[model samples]
Structure formats: structure tokens, C-alpha cells
Target: MRSNVLGSAADFRRGGHSSRRPLDSHLAQLFMRDLRADAPPQLPIFRSRLQGELLARLLLGPDREHTMLDLAVMLRTDLGSVVREVDRLARAGLLTLRRTAAGRLASRDTATPLHEPLAQLVMHTFGPKAVVAEEFGALPGAAEIHLFGAWAERYSGVAGEPPGDVEVLVVGAVDPGAAFDAAQESAARLGLPVHPVVRTVGEWRDDTDPFLRQIRACSLVRAR
Candidate 1:
């Protein structure tokens, strides 16, 4: 089902618009308002990192549901902010809210025509942060993980073609083999190539290294 949605999104982007419907006027206006606000460097499509992370989690896996507390923990945000964003998205018709026995649960509104395209956009843009964080955060001796290169450039609002792959920098004592395995897993989950370059903490801190210096000059989205 996930693959189908992603494939459909790809096809939708390739002139497969006959079946696509326009967004509701009210929803469009709401989205426009959100977009007009200052966006985060990690995912410039949305006004804030919280918004991007929230939408990416809900939309990318529409079948799953999460409570406000669950979302807060997963997103590393406050409960108040999660509640506000959930309310806003729910009002926009992008998410559905319901009270369960445990608590209020939020999930993607699959009924919305915007689901597919929006999910695709999230998958390509903000997806790397979430996916990479999950995959590499637990690596032994990994002190810091960052995303750089084409994907980082686009995410930082540099206009260009969509990134074909994700570039990652792992700084710590983690084994190179472990980093490679994590990269492979992340690539599989994202449907894009993930290239991870492991550097020791000392190497990353060195300012004289041309490669490290160049990476520092560009946008680097921290994953862990």
C-alpha cells in the first residue's frame, strides 16, 4: 500500500493529472497561510519544523494512528504545540481526530484528495529527517548525524531539481560497516539512495580539512 501510494504520487507528478482534483478553496487558503510563515531550514515547504514533522508522520503512513502524547514524544515537541498543530491540521481537513478509550487520536484523512500528492511531497522533503533519525540514532558510538548535499540544499529553499539521493555525515566512533548498513536500510525505507560518510569526531572538528570545510559551508540538517 505504501509503495502504491508513492508510485501513484510519482505518476501524478508525471502529467497524470486527469484524475487529480483541485483542493478545497478553504483548505487551500489555510495551507497558504501556513506556507506564508517562516519555514524551517530542514523542510522549507512548511512554516515550521513541527508542522513538517507532524504532517510527514501522519501522511506518510496514513494507516497508522497516534495520540497527542505519542505525537509529542515522537516529534520531540511539547504537548501544547502538538495539540495546536493537530487542531490546525484537523481543521484544514488534512487530518482526522477522534477520541479513543486511551486518548484523542489523530490520523491522516485518506478521504482527502490531497493525501497522495501531499504524502509524496513529505516523503521527498521531510521524510529523510524522520527516517534517518530512526535508522541511525541508535548506532553504537554515533555522536552526531547530519544530512548534507543536494537534499539539504533543496530543503533549505534552494530551487533546483529534486534530489536523487540523500547524503549523510556520521560523526563518532561508529564502525564504518555499521554506518553503511544503516544507510542501506534508510535508502530502502525512503525509496532513494542514501550515502553515509563516517568521520571521527576529531575529523569533523578539524577546520583545515577541505571536504569537511565545504560541508560546513552548506546546509546541514542534523538527524540525531
Candidate 2:
């Protein structure tokens, strides 16, 4: 029965809804495949970037229900993809889904055996953005926060080794001391070093500094 549900979920991904192929069948092979084992090590544990982002958002923080629209908008992906992935996860027992007046809601299934370990894995990899956002988002006078360096590069799809630490750039009137405290908290939460460098908005906009110029040349993932 479980296999049938999983197969039907796969069929949904294939633009069909009626097929009930076996779980191991070509069309019904694992919803989130281990295909990324050979891919460049950017969030390499997951089969696709969407998968990583979706799981990270749902698993890395407080367990709460989210509508499909919420996940799609947060991840900046299409609704169809989010719905499909949510359905796949729900069928796999990693997520639970139910209908409400607002729409279908999904949340991580804490009872699943994979929940704890998978959340831990996500916390170390795709978890940085969520952690940083939550920690630094409320900083008074802070205008912009972005993730840069190897982690940002990897998150932006630049192939490289997994990042050892997270580098953050804060641009605004934020106090350096407060930013440092936030970084420390984020690092503690993620089990990885988080370095947040503060710069005045004017300095960030200045094109004369070689360091700022270098940063502009690379990928920057907004934390807030």
C-alpha cells in the first residue's frame, strides 16, 4: 500500500495521476533520488536544489505547518514543483499533509525515523540561510544581510567543495558588536562557524575599496 502511494506520487510528477506502478519500477523509483552523489558538492546530499531548499525550510526550524503557496513563494519556485515535492514527501512519511480552509498544509513528520538525522544534515548544509535570517533579521538599522564566500557560491550553483564555514555581509547602521553576537548564535545553532562582517551602507556602495569590489564579483544570497 505504501509503495502504491509512492508510485502514484511519482506518476503525478510524470504528469499522470492514475498509474500505480511498483516502487522500484523505472517511473516510480525513489522520489528524491540519490542522483546527487556524483554531482558537484553544492548541497550534495539532495538530488536537486529545490529538494534541498524545500527540506531545509521545512526541517531546520520550529515544526509548523506551511501552505504549498508559502513554500513556493519562500523558495522562489513554481507552485507545481512545490506541490509535487510536498506530495512526494508526504507519501514517503517524512511529511504530513492536511487540507484547511486556506489550502493544503504540510509539516515535517517528527515521528519518521529519518527526521532527526535528516534535520541535522540539513542544519549543516542548507540550514545556514534560514539560521542567519532568523538571527539577524531583527537587527536595528540593518538594511541588508547577505551570504557570501564558498557557501554562497555553492548555494548559487558554483561547483566547489562544501563550505567549512558561513560568511555573511551586513550592510547598514548595525552595530558590529550586535552583528558579532548574532553570528555567534547562528554558528552555535548550525554547528558551523558563522562570520558576519558589518559595513556601513555608504561603504558597501563605495566602488573604490578592493575588498568590496571583490565581493561584488561573486554570488550573494540574501539572508533576509
Candidate 3:
């Protein structure tokens, strides 16, 4: 049933056009068809780290509304950079900006055809580390946090897709149960699996096992 609708939409894309049906409608249908079949389309690679980070926070983070000034401070980037990135994302149909009494506000464009799927992918790829840093930093016993595996490699600019699960290492005397509970909460919120390996500072420093050695040698994103 869905395929027939998609076939008609594809035909429209090829040539057919009507005054009653607008271009955006056809495009939305086409995008919906694609979403029905596979993962979301890939977003363009961002040249600026701050730009990427900003988008991830807007779409994947818990909050929906942010003023440009607030975003600049939160991302620790300059106001100019934040404005530029917001403009770029707006042009790309990935974000929506509106003028509010407080300031220029930005939020994800859920109305866009590809919004939900693209958001899921972005959150799965970049959201874990952000969530880990935000959620665990305040834990009483946590001393340090690290992200390893494919996500870490990609974050270090090695190039990789979002992995099935995020790998996290916590160095502290934190209760394993508490840490795992935190992981579970983060996972539920981020729409991705979170695998946390909790170890004492001494255990992490020992690095005796081959896996530990490899993880220690590779690029790691320190969450704390």
C-alpha cells in the first residue's frame, strides 16, 4: 500500500507536476519513502567542531529552545561562530530559528521531512558523550570519564559511523550499580545503548590487559 504511494511520488519527481500539489509536498513524500526503507540521510560533514557540537546539542540534547548568546556560552564558542553555524543549519533545513522576546532562539525543525530520523542518527552518534559528561560529572565519586571505541575514533576525526553502542570508562570509586543506573538512564534518554565500564583509578592506571592497553593508546574523549 505504501509502496504504491511512493511509486506515484517518484513519478511526480521524475516529471509530473500539478498546480494543486506544491513542490514541498512532493519532496516530503519522497523523503518519507526513503525513511521507510532505511536509515536517515547523511548530513554534510561540518568543517567546524563548534558548529557540529551546536547542532548536536540543539537536536539531541534535552532542551529545545536556546538563544544565540546562550548557545555561544554553552558551546564555549564565540558568538560569531554560533551565529554562523545557526545560519548554516537553518539553511540546511535541519534547524529552525525564531525571534523571541528574550533573543533569537533556535530549535530543531521537527516539521522537516527528515527531522526525526536525522535526529535519531545524530543523537546516536554524538549524543552519548555529551550525555555522559552532563549526567555523570556531578556523581559524587566520579573522578574522570572517558569515551573509547568507534565513537571516540570518529570524535578524534578518524571517520566512522555511529556504532551499535557507546563505550564509556569511569575512573573512580563510584558504586558500580549507581554507575550502571546512570548509564541506563542516559541510554534511555539518548536513544542509544550505553555500555559503561567502571574501574578504580588504580585499575585504569594499571592498564595490564591487551584491550585496556589498546583503549588507552587510542584517541579518547575525556567527558569530565
Candidate 4:
């Protein structure tokens, strides 16, 4: 399995369980597809470039309201650095400062305007049907469950104006074989590879699962 796709050599490697595609996901081999051109341009918010990406990711959803200490650990920086970044975000008008006992840390107050561009890219290039099929629409019980990760990241990442396209790894229910088939077909139809690893609630065990373990090591993109 590939490890910490954003931080490790895995991003450069040709193939892996996470990176590989079945015939159905895109319907054909992903063949030399370099989509950087199709991806969005970097934002000015990331310009001050003080690990603001982490701040952006944290703000993507209401769920990941991390403390200053949490941001400290995630950035592999000191509390002071995290605090500084929070201040930067506040000054940029992207965040509002909220105080608990933890000094001045910024609170996410609004939806990012940056999200739609990436979603639009996915929807435009791949088409909404494929985005929904390869993403939310086709997944069985996705509405019933949390239905996140690789798919949710489309909104979360772009919505957060993350450093890159949303890369998701979600948990949901499906007839394992059929779901996989749909994912394959959807990807083929979209002309790009969309990867997903679905496990049932009962089947989704501890971090020992290869994917989760890699994720634990470096889902730098996962808000927290």
C-alpha cells in the first residue's frame, strides 16, 4: 500500500493498491494522465504560505475543530507556530479568533469560496453524472452513513481550497463486488481514475487495515 500520498515517495511511484485502477473505475488504463494542467491554480490564501493549507483543511467541515495543540502536532511545529498561523489566517479575514483558555486561536466561520472551482473541474471534465456515480450518487447507503473520504474530499478539499484536488478514502456499505464494479465503470466513464476503499461498519476494523494504517501515518489532507 502507498503511504502518506502527499508527503511520501508514494505520490511518485507508478502503482500501488491505493493508486492502481481496475478496468471498471475508468473503464481503461489511466495511461500517462498528468492532470496538473486541469487542476486549479494555487490560491492567494496559500500565499502567506504558513502551513495555511492545514488551517484550510481544518476549516473544511464543522467536524474538525482542532485545538491549538492539535494543530501544533499536525503541523509538526511548536504551539507558537500554530498560534502564529492562526493569527495569519485571522488577519487574512478567512478566520475569526476565538479564545478559550488556549490563547488566540482562529475559528472557522465561513464556507470557502475556493471549493467550487475544483468541484466544477471534476464535474466539468468528468461530468456530473460520473462525479455523482464515481462519487456520491452511486454509492449504496452513502446517504445513510457518513459517506466521506475520497469522495467527500471533493467538496471538502475544494471547499477548503486545499492545496490540491480532493483525494478521498471513505467508509460506506455496498455489495462489495457490485460497488467495486460501479466505481470501476464510473472511473472509466470519467476518463480519470477515482479510487475508493469501502468496508462495512462491522468490517471496518482497527487501524491495522492497510489503508487506514497508511492514512494514520500521513493523511496530511484529512483535517484531523
What lDDT tens digits, residue by residue, belong to model 2 across residues 1-224? 13444465576778674464445554234334432123325555465666676777787544578899888777776676688778777877888998999999998888989997787677556688777887899889889999999878866767665577889999999999999999988776554678888999999999999998888899988987
Residue 123 Cα positional deviation in candidate 1, in Å, after optimal superposition: 4.8
lDDT of 4: 0.44
Pairs clashing within candidate 2? none
Q: Quote each prediction's TM-score.
A: 0.49, 0.48, 0.48, 0.34
At residue 55, candidate 3 shows an lDDT of 61
State residue 203's C-alpha deviation in candidate 2, in Å.
Answer: 0.5
lDDT of 3 at 120: 59
What TM-score number comes out for model 3? 0.48
Model 2: number of backbone collisions: 0
Number of the top candidate by lDDT?
1
Residues 93-173, candidate 4: write the lDDT tens digits: 556667777664555655667444433443333332324343445566652222244334443333443322233344556
- Each prediction's total of clashing residue pairs, residues at least 3 apart in sequence or on different chains, is 0, 0, 0, 14
Q: What is the C-alpha RMSD of each candidate to the true structure, in Å?
A: 14.8, 12.6, 14.9, 19.1
Q: Report the C-alpha lDDT of model 3 over 167-189, residue by residue, as the tens digit.
A: 88988999988888888776754
- Candidate 3, residue 160: the lDDT equals 52
